[model samples]
Target: MLKDNYGRRFYYLRLSVTDICNFRCNYCLPDGYQCGESIAREKPLSVAEVNTVVRAFASLGTEKVRFTGGEPSLRKDLVQLIETAVNVDGIRRVAITTNGYRLASQIDAWQRAGLDQLNVSVDSLDPQRFRAITGHDKLANVLRGIDRALELGVSTKVNSVLLREHNLAGFEQFLDWVKVTPVSLRFIELMRTGDNRDFFASNHVAGRDIEKWLLHTGWELLPRGRDAGPAKEYTHPDYIGRIGLIMPYSRDFCAGCNRLRMSAQGALHLCLFAEAGIDLRSAIASGDHRDLAALIRSAVCGKSAGHQLDRGFTGATRNLAMLGG
Candidate 1:
């Protein structure tokens, strides 16, 4: 098993498939994605490379792998990528975190390709606010896609970053939606990144406040699964859905970290807020599982205990889009 020096068993892998996002949220890509000559020159990992990488991780006891991106769905071969990961011998779960741009039109194909879990970013329930936050006016389309996934019995989750000035006041709408949606309604705490310092200062909202309110309202905390990502889940008898919080700034947040990130460029990231990554491009391209595992193990041995995000140390990540947070 991929156990770190801190004795944390790594069971999940967050794989970035691309770095081109369509959303320009106030906190993330506010000015829009800057697609330039650099992007044209450098391409993301190919299907064969991803297949080899996933196989290595699966061999090392990684059971769950979540595909992320500047919008993973943006990749035309995303279904092929999903199919590749699902076919790996020991992988038990295949999931994706996307912005839901093509979901309404393509979720059926994804479900057919063996995608079992889907996480869509829905910043706000209010249509206008959603547009303002995401710089796109497609809340209705996304909602339709969510319904389609539910019909197909895909485990779905809706992620909304808590923006103090944008969606905090609309919390009740989210709570009400989850009351009947039968999906995990997750609120992600806004994080400080290299380029989003000013935005983080003005918009960050603590996930703790929502937790307090949840407990007071009869929501019960539930235990986390070994292979689950870092979400503190809560459930209530009256609601079909569950509530989850990803509080990166909370004390000892990294103590429960069980996932490792691998950039689309074939670099291993011990922490999302890591200052640097160990390149594994050659190993991945060579399709040598042993070589890849050895490099991965070496990195895991020296993994930092925590991200220290509270200290204002934003590492190599200029924005969440860079790491698919």
Candidate 2:
């Protein structure tokens, strides 16, 4: 297994196929943000390159691979990429985190290509509030996609970013909606990252308070024994689905960190709050698999003890979109 300096075994890889997104969520992208000249000129790693990186990680005991993007569904070759990752020798699961705008049309193709899981970002069930949060009027489209995913027998989950001023009041309503769905709901605490610092300052909600409310509302907290993600999960006897809280700022789950992040540009990130990363693109381009593996090991071994966000640390300089949130 790939063991970091802190003795954490890294087995999950979150790979970003592209940094280009369709929606401009206020918490993720800055206001008035647009795909500009730099974005146009930027080239993400090729499918072959991504396969090579995945092979290296699998060889080092990586078992799960998740494709992320500004919107992974935007990629024309996503099905092929999923096929490549899932067919890798040691890779057991391949998944994607998408906005779900294009998911309905492509769900069949993705399932046939061996996608094991899907996480859709659905912040609000109310139509107007959904558009207000995502800067798009496709709430119905997203809901359709979610329904299709469930019908297709795909293991699905719904993610919502908790903004104190925007979505806090809708928490109970969100729970009400979840009661009728079969997919789990995860509420993510907004991270204080670049470009959204001011918004985060005003809208960041503590996961602890959310937990208290859930407990008071009769949701049963459940222990996630070996799951690798950051969320603390819960379930209610009366509901068909579960609820989760991911508190990156209000609480630290770094001690159980088990994944590494790879940017679309091929930078290997050891932590979500890491300031910088080691470039594996260059090593891959050199056609030296041994060298590339060594670089990956070096990067993991150099991971910091923990993200110091609680100690007044903001977050990575790159925004969530750039970092493939």
Candidate 3:
């Protein structure tokens, strides 16, 4: 297994297939935001290059791969990428994190392509609030996508970012809706990234407060015996679904961090808040698999202990969308 100097084993890769998105989320990007000229002109990695990167990670003990993006469904060959990742020598599962705007139409094709899990981002259950948050009128479509994924037997999870008075006020409604669904709901704390730093000052809600409210409102705190990524999960014995909180800023889960993030442009981010990255695109384009694997190992071994967000440090210059969310 690929272990960092901190003794954290690397077994998961969050690969961004594209930086283009269909929504202009209030907390993800500024209003009227457009793709930068450089990003507009640059091309994303081809399926062949993505396949080679996945193979290299699989050889280095990567067991789980999740395709993320501004919206992964926007990628034309996403199903093919899922298939490629799932077929990698040591990969056990392949999943995606999407906005679900275009998912319902392609869910079956994704299943056939060997997708094992889905994490759909749906911030508000209220259609009006949803439109206000996402700057889109596709809440109905997203709901349909979620229901279809559940109906099709896909292990689906809904992720909502807590935006203080904005979507946080809708948590009760969200939980009520989840009780009838076959999927879990996770509330993610707003990170103060470069793209949303201004909004963070007004909208960021601590995940602990959200968890406290959940517990106070009849939700039972379940013991998370082992690491389950960054989310702290809970459940209601009577409810069919689970609830989770991802608090990157309020609570640092770095000791258990075991994943690496590869941007759509091919930069390998060792830490989400780190400004610097290794240009794996150049390495992959110029080197052989063995050399690429060596570079990956070297990069992982040098992963930082934790991000400096607690010290009033700002996050990466790129927005969550650009960083694959």
TM-score to true structure, per model: 0.98, 0.95, 0.94
The regions of model 1 sitting more than 4 angstroms off are none
List candidate 3 segments past 4 Å from native. 39-41, 216-227
- Clashes by residue pair, model 1: none
lDDT (C-alpha) at residue 140 in model 1: 96
> Per-residue alpha-carbon lDDT of model 3 for 284-309, expressed as tens digits?
77636677899899888778888877
Q: Per-residue lDDT tens digits of candidate 1, residues 53-101?
A: 9998998899999999889988999999999999999999999998898
Which portions of model 2 miss their true places by more than 4 Å? 37-42, 225-227
lDDT of all the models against the reference?
0.92, 0.84, 0.82
Give me the displacement of residue 191 in model 3, in angstroms: 0.7
**Candidate with best TM-score:** 1
lDDT of 2 at 232: 84
Candidate 2: give the clashing pairs. none
Q: For model 2, what is the alpha-carbon lDDT of residue 230?
A: 73
